[model samples]
Target: MTATVTAPADRLLYKPEDAAEVLSIGRSFVYELMAAGELEYVELSRRCRRIRRTALEQYVAKLSPQSH
Candidate 1:
């Protein structure tokens, strides 16, 4: 027997650090992407921001194709 678990569709927000982990990149790179307007995020306040999972997926999809 096995169980299949999945995340909720409404669960989309993630911290920049979490995004970095997901992308296997440095946290500073995530900030740089934000600064370059390449990654989309929502500012909750003057010091709080959250990146949407959908945005991350879209960003990956928009990247240039990798060479073999």
Candidate 2:
């Protein structure tokens, strides 16, 4: 039998790539945000990390509007 994966809408955690997709930004920028502590993530292990959906929302909520 094959295993089933969680749908995007039902997911609480997201990989960096997934976060990038949701944010419409590049994956590298997601990593930069994580490195800079702008975005929060859960550390499952030394090599495993996942970003929470709330964290993404908070990040967006905190963005200042740009002046043009």
Candidate 3:
């Protein structure tokens, strides 16, 4: 038997590393994007940060040719 996983409807939370993996870019680039305000993030604590999955999807959508 195989198990299937599904994402939540809201999908508004992601770890920095997970976000980086989803974008297929370096973690450093994720920081750069966050610093540049290209990606929105939430600071959970002094040493923790998270990105919004919906925001990431929106960002990608904006980059699509049809969106431009």
Taken over the whole model, the C-alpha lDDT of each candidate is 0.82, 0.86, 0.75
Q: Estimate each model's TM-score.
A: 0.80, 0.85, 0.71
User: Better model by TM-score, 2 or 3?
Assistant: 2
> Candidate 2 residues 11-64, lDDT tens each?
899999998888888999999999999999999999999999888888887887
Candidate 3: C-alpha lDDT: 0.75
Q: Weakest 10 consecutive residues, lDDT, candidate 3?
A: 1-10
Clashing pairs in 2: none
Evaluate model 2: give its TM-score.
Answer: 0.85
Model 2 weakest lDDT span, ten residues long: 1-10
lDDT tens digits by residue: candidate 3, 33-68? 889998889999998899887777766656634343
Score candidate 2 by lDDT: 0.86
Q: TM-score for model 3?
A: 0.71
> Over the stretch 1-68, how does candidate 1's per-residue lDDT look in tens digits?
22222324676888899888878889999999999999999999999999988788778777775579
Candidates ranked by lDDT: 2, 1, 3
